[model samples]
Target: MNTMFDSSNPASAPRVWEVGALCHAIGDALQARFNPVAVRGEISGFSRAASGHCYFNLKDAGGQIRCAMFRRNAEQMGFYPRDGELVEVRGRLGVYEQRGDLQLVVEQLQRAGQGAWFEQFLRLKAKLEAEGLFDTARKRPLSTMPRGIGVVTSLGAAALHDVVTALRRRVPHIPVVIVPALVQGAQAPQSLVDALQKMYLLAQSGQGQEADLAQKSPLIDCILLVRGGGSMEDLWAFNDEQLARTVVQSPVPLISGVGHETDFTIADFCADLRAPTPTAAAELVAQPRELWLGALDLLQDRLESAVQRVLDRSAQRLDLAAQRLGRPSEQLSRNHLQLARQAQRLRHAMLFKLQRMTQNQQALQAQLPQSLQRRLEQQKQGLERMDLRLQLLDPRLVLQRGYALLTDTKGKPVTQIKQAPPGAALKAQLADGAVDVVVTQPRLL
Candidate 1:
């Protein structure tokens, strides 16, 4: 405390000063006196500006002091503050010259007496991280354009409304299903688990009966877990270990938008994608209709070019084949000439063979007649010779030459006559005549 002029000491007339000078001096004094203080109070009038600066009042049962947290400082604090939260703020105590108000330029803040929740959060986080649950390698990738999307949030939540509006505007044809659940309160975590299971079933089954969609044709491609911004206590349901594990094990990809951009929870790390807001999540899952149409047009142009090139190639091939083919009429004329030559040779060979066979038949006919004439002459000569020999041996000729013959009455010729048997009749024969006689005696002569 500067004791330059003590009004209690009755100093000769107190030092007169302008209001601006007085305020400046007080500010300077306050800045120099107290620094790096820890003020325990309940938060009130808490609000964050667009510049990321935080403004609030710290109060107890008796009085309150104004506070300001700059964008740079509050950013490092890692959590947003809400009204009526008991907190201990660390800052430099000072006075604002313009408003003549005492204030605290906050550097950091801690939630008063709720260290156990933070500790539990850290423990579960450590366990999951050790198990590689938050590994980027293990995370699933969201489809570029989901067929259908499922959402798990309170039906009355403003987050749901924002998400629907964004999705419908982007892709009016894409289907969106709401898996309603309590997003806060004691039953919130289990509700989240059941809702996620139902969503996964809906995705795998490709059925809209349980997912509550109009058509059952398209499958659910991704799930969104979203809620509006709230204090850490209000958002604690998302920090449940079971819920985080369920998100990690989801059948389809999951996006977490639980709370504002500055707020985060265990669910955010476990999800396949983390969106800053529900509207952002919806945008990530859908593609604009105009963009899709433009892409299709480009592909159509490429296809037409390829087909034309193929057709040109085919026409060129057909022309080459036509050039390679020869005239069929010329080929047939050559074949006809060769066939005529072969037929002439065949006719000459037949005539020559027939003439040779005729000459051989005439020679055989001439030999047959001569052979028959020679055989007839040989037979006639043999007959004439035999006749001559028969004439020489004739007995009539011998009789004419004085030869005589005798015969018995029996008409047998007898070279020796024993004189006929006594009383037997006999005949004596001359060459020309014969006489009969009777024998009186037998004699050998």
Candidate 2:
């Protein structure tokens, strides 16, 4: 490094300056003139390094300047910065010694109209809060097991892929219904409302009696409204008051997963649940299939144990009954002894009655012969008296006493003299014989 000087008028001669010293001199002048400056420009060629330092160019029609924002300052930014976005930065102007270039070291960076947007956001938030849309009591708990899931997002968004992938992995059996809509433009709020209303129609169809409507629409138990990370201006659609009101009208629980963890929107406050990311929203509605299967197995085991216990108790009761009952053979032997004693008493009574009847018949037989002999003697004496009376009146006895029996020739006895007439022949019956006779004279005497 040679130092050169002009020799004309030594005090006023130009001093020789080294390259490093000249660079230092320029840096000092910049620091004193505009050390802290605020510049508004469009960002260009912005990139973050591995060390968390951000490097970019801020440009306008007048000129462009190199800028650097360290990690500490970048973290404090409310929104992500991108190329072509108009932003205002407050920093110190300095010269880089190594490259001899002018640079700005940014201490803070914000969107060009961030203050106005922030005021609007705050006003909307306060209005909705007063209406109780953000109240915890208004928020419903998500279904533990959803029959079907409805998704509302752009068809081409990365958020759709993340949400669908998570749901399929956890609950492949459950069907998913996607209603695509714009999620970032001016029309995004109304598009989201229409998509949600379609899903609401499907949910109502399942509960109604309209079989046609139910058949045409797939039932959804819950809805997920999701979008990827973006700048505050890019995500302003979700902050719309109309979109927030539509979120509250969901028939089933609705989950809002609209940005990165650091982002917030009005829809998130009105929704039933809020998730930090799209994938997290899907996981909240789906439970793992293996977990449910484990619960079923536990219930089956409990039922089998209950049935086995009942059978064991029945067997114990049967054993106790058998112990209390005596043997059948002992009961039969006691009945047989009582029957034998009754038969013996009946046989002895029959023998005594037969003996008394036989003795009475023998006494009657001994008296019968004496009664017959007395009756025969009395009958013979009566017969003798009748015979004596008959002998006293006999006709032969009168003849033997010298009385004749006179009879006529015809053998008729003449009892009167008048019966014998003159010239009449007569027969006389003496005691020995009969004599014939004729009557000469008759007398009355």
- lDDT string for model 2 (361-434, tens) is 35333433443335434433433343344333344556678877776666565788778888888876666766
lDDT of 1 by residue, 281-334 (tens): 888888887887676556545533543454344345434433443322234335
Q: TM-score each candidate.
A: 0.55, 0.51
Q: Name the regions of candidate 1 deviating beyond 4 angstroms.
A: 1-37, 41-76, 81-87, 91-108, 111-116, 211-217, 323-445
TM-score of candidate 1 relative to the true fold? 0.55
Q: Give the winner by TM-score.
A: 1
Stretches of candidate 2 off by over 4 Å are 1-109, 113-115, 207-218, 327-445
